[model samples]
Target: MSKEMQEKTIGFDSFPVEIIHDILRYLRKADMSTLYSCIRVNRNLCKLVIPYIWNNPMPNTYSLINLEIFINLFDEKDKNLLKNQYELDIDDTYQPLFNYTSYIKVLDPRGVRRAAFYWLKNYYVQKFPYSDIYVDFKNNPIIDIIEKSLLRIILKNSSKIENLILDFAEKYQDIPSCNIFLLKELQQGGEGGESNQSEQLSHGIREITKLSIMNPSLKRFDNIQEFLDLLPTICTNIKKIKFYDLFFIEPTMELKLCNVIKSQRNLTSINLTYNIFGLISVIRHQRNSLKKLVLRYIHHNDICLFNTFDQLINLEFLEINECFPINIILEPLIRANLKLVTLKIIDIEGIEGKYDLVESIIKSSGSTLKHLSLNIYVDLIEDKLPLSKLCPNLIHLDLKVSIRVIDEDDDIDVESKKQPTIFNYIDSLKHLKNLHLEFAFYVIGYFEEFDQYINFINFPSLRFISLKDQHYSSNFFKRWFEHFSTMFNKITFYIDSESDEYYFDPLDDFVQEMNDNGLSLVYTFDGYSNFVATDRILC
Candidate 1:
C-alpha cells in the first residue's frame, strides 16, 4: 500500500474502540453492503461488524448467493440431514466460518417461507419450460417440509428468542397439526405423554410477546377459525396484535377473534386494516388494557360497531382511514366520549354530513386531543367548519380542501353563502404546531384568488405547513411559500402531478431562490403510495 494510504488506515485504527463500535453499529443497521466492505479494513473492524451482520442472518428476500451462505452455516451433521431428508443439494466446496444461527434472538418464519418459495420458483423457471398454469406452491409438499425444517432448526438454535411474527400462510391454514408439531419440538421434554406434551407446548409458545400476522395479500384461508382461537391459548401474555390487509372478514373468524380477545387480557394495542369484523370483535370483548387502536377502510355500515367504543376505558390513540359516509360515524364516536390524545380521520367522503360530523368530533375531544388530521370531502374554503372549537391542546393539524375552482355559469350567489373562509378561525387554536393543508383542484391561473385567501389569517403556534395532494405549477407553489415563509418555521410543497418539462425549470429556480434568501422551504413529489408524507422527495 502507498504511504498515504497506510497513514489514513492508521488514523482510523487510532480511534477508541467505543467510537469504532458506535460508527459500525450505524453502518451495520443502515447500510449492510457498506458494513460488509469494512470487513477488509482491519481486524478490529471485522470483529465489531460480524456480530451485527449475523444477529439477523436469514435473508428475507430472494438472493441465491445469500441462501448459499445460510446453507453453509450448518455443520456437517445438519448439512447431511438436509441432504438426506429434504433432498436439498449442499455445496461441498463452500464452508462457513461460524454458526450464524446462534446469534439470532428473533425469528420470522413467514419471511423464510416467502424467500424459499421465491428461490424455488426462480430455480424451476430456469430449468423447465414456462407454462400458463402456474405452480401451485400451496399444495407443494417439498416446500412445506423445507419451510418447517428451516423454522425448527432456527428455533432450536436460537436459545433466547424474544420476538416471533407469524404470517398465517397456506401451510398454517391447511395443516391443523403444524402448530402442535412445531411447538412439540420447541419444548425440552419431547417424550412426555400427550397431556404433559400439550402443557409443555403452551409453555414453549408463551416466551414471545410481540406478534404480527402481516398477510398483505389478504388471502382467505380454510380453517381460519381454529387458527385464530389457537393464538391466545399459546401466547397467553401477548401484548400487541397487528393485522394487515385482512380483507376477507368472516363471521366465524370474527367470533374466534373475539374469543381470543376475551382470553388475552394483556393485549394493549391492535392495528388492523379493512377488517370490520375484527374491529367489531375488539369492541365486543371490552378489554380495559387496550390503549391504542387503528382502523382503516371503515365503511358506512360499520357505524353500529362504534356503540361499544364507550366500553374501552383506557383507549387513548385512535385513527380511522378511508372511512365512507364519514359524517354519520361522529355521533356514535362523540357519544362514546373517548378522551383521545391523537385522533386522525383521513380520506373522509360523503355529501351532506361532512360539516357537522367534524364539528362534533372536534368539540367532543377539544380538551384532550393533541394531534388531528382530517381530509374533508367538500371544498374546505367553500364549506368551512368551525376550527375555533378545536382541541385546546392540539399540536398537529392536517386539513385538505378538495375544490379550488368555481364555475362561472353557476346560479348560486357566492355572497349569499354563510360558510366561513379557510383562514377565518385558525387564530383561535393556541397550541397548534404542525400544519398540513392540501388544495386539490385546478387553480393554475388563479394565483390572485389564492393569495387573497391567504391574507386573512395567522397561526401563532404554527411551525410548518405542507401543501400537497394535487397538481399545481411549480412557480405558483414557490410564490405561495415565499409569501408565507415568515408565517411558518418551514414550508413544504408536494406537487403530485406536473408536466416533466414545465416542473424542472421552476423547481430549480425555487430551490435556488430558497438558498439565496436563507429560507426553509422544500419542494417534493408524490413518488410512491399516493400523497403520504413518508413518500420520497425529488428535491
Candidate 2:
C-alpha cells in the first residue's frame, strides 16, 4: 500500500457513545445488518449493538438461527423482545417469504389435508355472526381422518362465514364425502330443535356473500341439490363470485355462481383468474354489483371475451395476466365508463406495440387511471413507453422488464447506431412519485460528464423503488449508494432469500472509513425473501 493511502486512518474511539449511535442509526439498515454479524470483533461492542440489531429489518443470516431460536426458544424472552424492542417489519413485494413455510414439506397427502383443515378452519370459521361454508372436498382421496374430522367440524358448527374460499384441487374419494357433507350441513332440523346447539349453530338459512372455488378436480362433487340449497342462501348475501382454474365452470358450478349473483343484491368484486371458468355470462350479468375484476393466465382463445367487457359498469382494479393466448383488444376496456384505478397486464412483448397500445389508452382514459403495473419480457425496451404521456397522473407503477441476452460478448457494433436509455422521457413526469423499475441492477448512464446524453433523475417527491431479481455485489452497492444519495430517504435492495440474518455490520474500519468520507447508507436486502437494506447519507 502507498504511504498516502496508508495514512488515511479509520478513527477508533474518536467519538463519544451518543455520536457513535447517531452515526450507526444514520447508516443504512443493510449496513447495520452487515455490522451485527461481525459484532464478535469486540465484546463491549456486542453488548452495545446486539439489542438494536434485532430492531432493523436486516436479513436473518444467523447460520445458527436454530441457535437464535435456542437463545429465545420460550415465550418469555422472545415475546418481550418482539413487543418492547424488536420491530416487526414486513414488505409484501419481496416475492416469497423465508420463514417456516420454506422448511416444511408434505411427507404424506393426509398431512397436507390435515394442515389445510386447521389453517382454513381457524381462518374462516370465526365469523359466527354470518352464514354458510364451502369446504373444498373435491377429489380428496379416501375418507381418511382429515375428511372425517373436517366434515364433523362443519356439520356441527355450520352457520357462519358468508363468503368461503375453497381449494377445489382434485384428488379422489371426495365424491361421496362431498355429497354426504353438504346434505347434512344444509339440512334444517324440525320443531323443538331450537335448543342450545341450534341457538349457537343457528341454521336459519345462512347467507353467503361470495365463493371462490379454485381446485381443478370437478368429477367428484355429486350433491347438486344440496349444493344448490346453499346457493339460495349465498344468493341472499353474496354479491360477487369466482371459479378459478376450472375451464368449464361445471353445470353445477355455473348454476351456483350464477344463482348467487342473481340472488345477492349487494355483490361486488368478481375475479375469475386463469380463465378456466367459461362463465363470462355470469361475470357480465353481475357487472352492476362487481367493482374489482381480475382475469389472468386463462388460455380462453376467444376474441369475444375482450368484446364483452363493456357490460361491467362498476369495474375498478383490473389485472389480466399472461393473456398472450387470448387476443385482448384494449380499446373497449378503456372506453367502458368504469372508474379504473389499477390496470396490470402481461405478455405484451413488443415495446412499440406496448407504447402504442398504452398511448391509445392514455388518450382515452389515462387521466382517470391512477395505478398501472406491466411486466414485459423483451431484449431492449424501445422509447421506454413515454410513461409521462399515458400515466401522467399515475402514482404506483409496478413495472417489470426482463431482457435476455445470449452472453456478455461486448463486441457488438456502435458509432452509426443510436440507442439511448429507457428513462429519456422521464423529464415530463411531474405527477409521479412512487416508481418501481425491475431491470439490471446498474444505472446505465450514471456517473458521466456534461457530454453525456442523459444527465440525472429528479423525482422530487418520489419515495420508493423496488428492484426485483437484481442482486448487487458489495463494492458496486457502495458506489451505487454514492450515486443516488439525493433521491430517497429510504432505499431497499431486495434479494430472493429470507432465511439467515442479512443484518450484520460490515467491518467497523470500513464503515468508519466511509463515515470519514461523505457516504450515507440506507437499506440492505439479503434474505431468502425481501428484508430491509438500511442505510442513509451522512452529509
Candidate 3:
C-alpha cells in the first residue's frame, strides 16, 4: 500500500472502539448500503454491522433470503423435522458464522408468512415444473408447517421481541396453528412439550411494547378471540395497540378485546377502526395513561358514548378518519382541553356543525399543536378557514379539499364565485414549515388565481410544499417558478387521475429545466395500486 493510504488506514484503526461503533450505528440508520459496505471493510466493522442487519430483517425485500439464513441456524431436530415431515431439505453440516437469530428484536408474522408463501411457491415450481401442483400451493399444508417452524426457531433463539404485528386476513385457516405456537412459546414449552423454563422465559414475548392486530373478517373470530384472551395473561407491559378493519366484532368478543386493553398497565396509544361495543367505556379506563388515540370509520350511532373522550387528559395526538357525526366526537375533545401536538381529521362526514366543531377543536389545542391535517369540502375553503388564528403553532399543515359535482345543466357562474384561496388564511402562521394541498378534482380556471395568491403571500419558515390529486400543466408550474422559485426549497406534485391517457411530456421538460437551474422539483404519478416516478431530484 502507498504510504499515505497506509497511514490513513492505521489512523482509522487506532480510533476507540466506542467511537467506531457509534459511527457504524449512524451509518446503519442513515443508509443500509453504506453499512453493508462498512461490514466488508474489516472484521471489527463486520461484528458491529451484523447485529444491525439481522435485528429486524422483515419489512424488507431481502427477508426471503434472511429467512433462509435463519432456517440454516436451526438445530438438528428442526432440520430433521423440515426434511422428514415437511419434505424440505437443509444442510445439517452447515453452520452460520454468527448466532444471527439471537439478534432478532422485531417479529412481523405477516412478512414471515409472505416470505414463506413465496419460498414454497418457488420450491414447488422447481420441484414439479411439468405438473400443475404448484397452482394450488397456497392451500398446501407445508406452508403452515414452514411458517410454524420458522416462528419456533425465532421464538426459541431470540432473547427479546420488541414488536409483534398479527394480521390474520383472507386466509386465516391456512395458519390456524400460529396462536398455539405463540402460546407454547410464551409458556416456555416447545413442540414436544419439553420445558426450558429459565431460558425460554427470557425469549422476549413478554417484553413486547408494540402490538398491531388487523382482523378484518369474522370468519376466524374464534381464533382471534382466543389469541386476544391470551394476551392479557402474557403481555402486561404493552404500550401501543392498533386494531384495524374490525367491522364485524360481536359483543362478547369486544368485551374480551377490551379486557386486553384494560389489562395493560402502561398503555399509552390505541388505534381502533369501525365500531367496537363499549369502546368508549373501555378507553375511559386508560384515559390517564393514554397519550395517542386514533378512530377510523367510526359510524356508530351512539353520540352520547363519545363523551368519554373528555376523560383523556394526557392525550397529545388525535386522529379521526371517515367518522360521522364528527361534531359529536370533537365536542368531547374540545371540552377535554387536550394539549395535542398532532391532530388529523380526514374525510370527516357531517352536514351540521362540522366546521364549528373543527375550529373549536383546533382553538382548544392550538397552543401545543405542531402538525394539523384536515380534509374538508371545497365550499368551506371558499368560505375561508381561519387556520392561522386557530392553530398558530402548527409547523406542518395538510389541507385536502373535496367538492360536490356540478351538472352541465346548472346555471351557476363558477368563475364569478369568490373562491378564497388557502393563502388568505395561512399568511399569519409564521412557524409553518411544510404545506400539503390535495384537491378531489381539478378546478379548471384556478391556476391564475393560485399564482396570484402565491405572489402576495410570505412564508418565512416554509421549506416544502406538496400538491396531490390534481392535474397541473407544466406551463403553470413554469410560470409559478418564474415568479416565486425562492419561496420553497422543494415542491412535489402527486398526480392522481382516473384515466391512463394523461401525458407528462411538458412536465418532464419542466422537471429537467428546474434541475438544471439548481432547484428541486419532483413529479410522482399515483394510481390505485402503485406509484410511478416521473422525475426525482437527487441531493
Candidate 4:
C-alpha cells in the first residue's frame, strides 16, 4: 500500500459510527473553524459533519450558488405547475443532481431574500453585458416571487424543519411597491390573483415549529392582521411565538390579533414587544398554558394595561424592559405572586415606591428566583433593594448602578452615601453563582472606592463575574482582578472608552494568564473585545 493510504487507515476510519457521531456532536458545538477542519479530515468525517453543518446553514453571498442548484431540482412537472398555477416564470435549462433542499431544517426567509437578490444581480450583469444596469432589485416583484418559491419548495421537501424565522417584513418595508403575491398574475388572467397561495404555503410546512417573526413591518400594505391570521394555516402547532415591534391600529384589529394568538392551542411561550393595551387580551388568552412571557419598551400610559400579567398563573419566566411609570407595574407584579424562577427588569422610570417594589418582588419570589437582573439608578447604600437579605437562592444576578456627578461646592446628599456601598450585601447571598456589576464613574476617587468595596465582598459560590465600566483605565481593573482567587471559572472586564494601545496591552496579557490557569477571560476596551461569550456560557 502507498504510504499516504496506510497512514489514512490509522485515523478516525477505524472508529465506530456511534463514536463518530458523538465526536461530531462535540464538533458541532465547537467554533466554525474547528468544524470546517473536522469535515476535511476524511470522507467519513465529512459525511458525518455535513448534516450538522447544513442543518442551520449560514446564508450569505455564496449561498446563492447552492440555492441555484436547489432551484434546478424542481422536476419538470413541479415547474410547469408553478408556471400554470401561480403564473411564475421558470428557467428550465439547468438540471440539478442533488436534492439539496432536504438538508435544510431551519429556514430564515430574510436570508433567502438576500441570497435571491445577489443571484439576480449576478444573472442580470452577465445577461446585459456592456449595459450600465443600476437595477433596483428591492422593488422588483420577480425577486419576491423567486424568494417565496424557494421557501415553498424547501418547506415542502424538508419535513424536518422544526425552527423557522420569517423576518423580511422590516428589511423590505422600504420597498412598498413589492408584495409577495404581486409577482404572479391572476391564473384566471386579470388582477385578483390566485387566492390559494396561502394554502399552498401552508401545505409546504408539515411539522410543528418554533417561530420568530421579528418586526413584521407589514403595516404599509394594511396586512399585519392578515399576516397574523395566516400563521395558523402554515403551522397548525406552533410551540413558541416571538413577536416583536408590533403596532396596534385599533381595538378591533387588536381583538383580531388576540383571537389569532388564542387559536394556537399548543403555544406555551409568548414574547411580545411594545406593551399596547391590546396585549392584555393576548395575555388573557394564553394565561392557562403560557409558562414564559417577555414585554419590552412600555410607555408610562401602558403601565396599568399589564395588570393582565396577574392572570399568568403558570408563568415561570418574566421579563420587562424600559417600563415607565414603574409604580403601576409594581403592584400587579407583586400581586401576581408567580413564584417565578427568572425575572429581569430594565430601564424603569419613576422613583416613588420603585425601590420598595424591587424589594417586594424579591421577597415574594425569593425562594424560586434562580435568575434576577435589574438596571436602575439609585443611592447604592441607602436604596431599599435588599438583595442579600431577600434572595438566598439566586443563581445569577445582574445589577447596573447609575451614579450622578455632583459639584464640590454643592451640598453633597449624605443621605445617598450613608453607610456601606452596594457590595456590603453581597456576602448574604450564599447561593449566588454568577454576578455582573456595571457602573459608570467620572471621578477617579469614586472609581477607586467602588473597586475597594468589590474587593472586600465574599462571593464563595461565584463562578462567573462580569465588570463593566464606562470611564476608567485598565490599571484600575488590573488591581481589582488581583483580589479574586482562582475559584472564579470565568471573569469578564469591559471598559467603554476610546481605545488606548498602552492601556489594553497589559489587559490582554492578564487575560492570557487567566486562560492558561484554567479560567476564561473576556476583556473588552474601547467598545471592542477579544472574547465573545455565547448563550451557552451565560446559561
Candidate 5:
C-alpha cells in the first residue's frame, strides 16, 4: 500500500469486528442497518457484525434476543439462553431506538422487539451475561414477525430471565386478539369474561414494582370499594401504579380514586396524571403510607374547596398543577401532621403573598426540605413575602412576583426603581439556580443591577430556569446558561398571560418576528379555569 493509504486505512479493514461494530453502533440506526446489509455481503464482515448485532449499552444493556422475540420463530422450549438477560433502558430518555424504523417496517415504529431478539438468538445469547429483559415493544411489521418467533424462545429462557419489563403502550405486537380483548373487556362488557371484581382482582401482579396502564381500555367500574380493596391485596408488592389518560365522569368517580388510595396502604408512590380524578376528592382520604404523590389537572378553583391536607404525613415530594383554593390548602397541613421535602406549585390563584403554609412545613419538618417552587397570582399584594424563614433549608428556589400595576398615564419618572414592589424580599434569594418565573416588571425593579439592590448572586448550580410572564433581562438568562451542569433536566420557561376574567395568555398566535437571530423564550399555559392562569416555560 502507498504510505498515505497505509496510514489512513491502518485499523479500518483489519480491526476485529467487535471493534468495528462498536465504532459504528452509534451511527444513525438507518446508516448502521445499511452498513449491516452491505457487511453481510462478505463472510468476515458477517461474522464480526453478527456476534455484536444486538448489543447496545448506553441507556441500559440489552441482549435484544429473548424468548419474547423468538416465540414466533421457535417453540416456547426451543429458545435457550446463551447467557443471562439484562435490560437497556435505565435512563428515562423517550427517543426512538431504531433510526428510520418506519421506512423499513413500512408502518409506524413502536419498539425494536423483533430485530433485537433475532440478533440475540442468532449470535450473542451464549456469550454474555444477560439478566434483565426489557420488552417495551412497539408494534411494527418486521417487529411483529420477530416477536412471534420469540415466544417459544422466551418460554425456554424465562426461568433464566430474572427481570422483564413490559413498557409497551396499550397495544403491543405479537399479542393475540384475545389478550387485547381482555384489557378492553370492561370497555365492551359483552361476549367475554365480565370484569367481576371478585374474580379479576389485582392479585397476579404482585411482583410488579412499576406498572403504567397508559391508554387503558378499562374505563368505568361498577365496583368501587371492591377495586380499591384489591389494590392493597392484589398488588401487595407494587410500589407505583401510574394511570395515564383515564377519564372518570360518573358520580362515583371521586369515591373510586379515594377508595383506591385507601387500598394502597403499603404503596410509596402514586401518579394519576392526565386521569379524570380531582384533587379534592383524592386528597380527602388518608394516604399516610404514600411517600410521593403527583396530581395533575385537578382544576383551578379558589372557592375554599381544596383544604391543605396534613394526612399525607409521609409525603416527601408534592407536584400539583392546574389546581386551586390557595389559602385553604396550607392551613390544615400546618395545623395537622405533614412532612414534605419537595414542592412545586404552578398556575393557581388566591396565593397572592402567603408564606404561612410553607413556613409551617419548614418548621414542622425541622428544616428537612431541600427544594421549593411557587408560581402564584399576587398582583394585589402590597407586602413582599418572606420565604427564607419558611424554607430555611431550601437548596433550590423559583419565585415570580408581581408588583402593583402601573397606569398608562403614570409619569415614567414618577415610578422609582428603588422602591420595592410587592416582591422585593424574594430577589435576595441569591443561592438559587433552576430559576423559574414571569417576574413582575416593577416588582423586580428593586433588584435592578443599576442600583446596588440587585446583588450578583452566583447560582453555580442553576441549570434550568422557568419564567411565566415575569419580565426579566435576557442578559441574566445568558449568564445562567453558562453555569448549569450537563445533567440538568430541561431548562424550560413557562410564561403565563394575564387578563381580568383570568390572568392567562390571550394570544391568537405567538407571532415572533425574527429580524436576525433566534432568541430564548419561556412560556407556561394554565387556561383550564377562567379565574386562574398557568405559567408556560419555553426554553
Candidate 6:
C-alpha cells in the first residue's frame, strides 16, 4: 500500500459521538427510511438511530408495527394478562435489543388507540376467518384495554415526553378514560410496584411542553375534563396549545380548557379552529408571552368577541381563516398597533368592508410584517391597495385572486383595469424574496395580462415565484419564461384542476425547452392537483 493508503482509515464511527448523532438526527427529520437503513450499518449507528425511530413512532406510518413491538416489550406478567384476558398471544421469550418504550418522547394516545384497534382486528380476522367478529372492532373492550396498557407502559418507562396530541375524532366513541394512568395512580405504583418506573412516569408527564386536542366529543367531555384538570397540575411548562373542531363545547368544559390554558407558565402559541367560542378571555391570560395566534372557521358571533386581541402585546404572528365579520376581528388588532411579523387571512369572501379592514391591518402592522397572505376578491376593491407603501419590509407575499365580470358583453378590459389595482405595488416591495399567486376559478384568462405587470426589471430582489392556476395553458408559461426566466433562481408552478381528463403534452414540451436552455425543470402529475413544474436555473 502507498503511504496515503497505509494511513489509518476513518469510518463514520470514528467521528465524535455527538456529530454522528446530529447527522442521524438530521436524517431522521428528513427521511425515516434512510435513517432506518443507517441503523444496519453498525451497532453504534443502530444505537444512535433506534431512539429517533422510537421517539415519536405513533404519528408515523410504522405505528402499527411499533405498537406490536411495544406489546411484546411488556413484562411476563402483563404478557400473561394479554394472552388470558385479550387472547393476544405473545412470545414470552422475545425481547427487544433496547428498552424501546423508554425512548418515546412524544405520545399520541389517539394514534395508539387506532393502532391497537387495527392490531386486534387483524388478529381476530386471522383467528376467526369465517366470522364477522372483527367488523365491530371499534366497539371492542379489548382494544381499549390494550391501548390503556400501552400508554401505561410508555408513561412508566419514558424518560421525558415533550409533546402530546389527543385526536379523538367522531368515530372514536370508545376513547379510554384518563383515570387508568393518572399521576396519583402512577406515583402509588398502582400496577407494577416499581418506584423507579413511577418516578419516570411522573417526570415524563411533567415535561410535556406541547399539546394538541382535535375533534373532542361533547358526550365524552367528562373524561376529557378529567384529563384537562390533570394537565394544569402536571404540564405547567406547555408552551403551545391547539384545539380543533370544538363546535359545541359546554360552558363547564370550556371553563376547564381555559383553566388548562391559564395554568401554562410560558404559553406562546394557540391555534383554535372550527367554531370555537368563549376562549378569548382565557387567551388574554397569556397576552404577555403569546407570540402566535391562529383562528380558523370562527363563528361571526365569536369574531365580535375578539375585542381583547389588542391586549396581546407580544403577538407577532396571526392567521384568520374563514371567519366572518372581518372588520370586527381586525378592529382590535389594528387598535393594538402591533408590529406583527406574519399575517394570513384566507377564505373570507362575499363580506362587506373587507378591503378597508385589510387595509387598516396592513397600515397597522406593515412596518414589521415580513410575510403576508391574503385570499380576497381583488376586483371588488375599487382603490389601489397600498401594500408596497405600508408593508415595505415584506419578504413573502401570497395572494389568492378572484375576479368576475357582471356583464359578459361589456367588452371592457377588466384584467388590465383591475389587475394593477391589486398588484401594482409588487415592484415597490424591494425586500421581497417570494411571490405566490393563486388565481380563482372565474379568472382563467387573466394570467396573460397579469404577466405583463411582473418582470425582472421591476422586482429585482425576487428569487422565487409560485403560481396556482386551475387553467392549464402552455402559452402562458412560454410567455412567462420568455419575460422573466433569467430573473428567478427558482420557480414552482402548481396547475390545479378538478377534471382528470386534461393532458400535459404541451406543458411537457415547454418544460423540456426550458431544461435545454440551462435551466433544470421537473414536471410531475400529482393526482387531482394535476401538473407541477419546479424550475431551477443552472447559474
Whole-model lDDT per candidate: 0.59, 0.48, 0.68, 0.62, 0.44, 0.71
TM, every model: 0.71, 0.56, 0.80, 0.74, 0.49, 0.84
Worst 10 residues of 3 by lDDT: 528-537
Q: Indicate the TM-score of model 6.
A: 0.84
User: Ranking under TM-score, best-scoring first?
Assistant: 6, 3, 4, 1, 2, 5
Candidate 4 C-alpha lDDT tens digits along 1-539:
99999987786678899988887778777775688788778777777777777676636445444455655655455566656864544565666543566677777766777777777667666777777866455676556666666765666566377776755355465322222322222223323345654433333333645776655454544454555556554456766777776664445555655665777776788777775556555677778888887777766565547677677778788787776666676677677777788988876342324767767777887788889888655453355555677777889988776655447785657444632556665556778777876653432335445455665677666666766655556666666655654344344555444567687677668767776544344434555322212122222
Model 1 / residue 317 / CA error / Å: 1.3
lDDT of 2 at 125: 51
> Backbone clashes in each candidate structure, one number apiece?
0, 56, 0, 0, 64, 0
Cα lDDT tens digits, model 1, 255-337, are 66556556765777777767456555565464578777777776746566666765665768877777665544565666666
Off by over 4 Å in 5: 1-69, 72-204, 216-233, 248-260, 274-286, 300-308, 348-350, 353-366, 377-385, 403-424, 427-452, 456-539
| Top candidate, metric lDDT | 6
lDDT of 2 by residue, 477-538 (tens): 44444555454344343433332334323422344565534433344444221212223334
- Candidate 2 vs candidate 3: the TM-score winner is 3
lDDT of 6 at 64: 50
* Greater-TM-score candidate between 4 and 6: 6
TM-score of candidate 1 on Cα atoms, chains taken together: 0.71
Looking at candidate 2, the ten consecutive residues that score lowest on lDDT are 58-67
Residue pairs in collision within model 6 = none
Better of 5 and 6 by lDDT: 6
Best by TM-score: 6
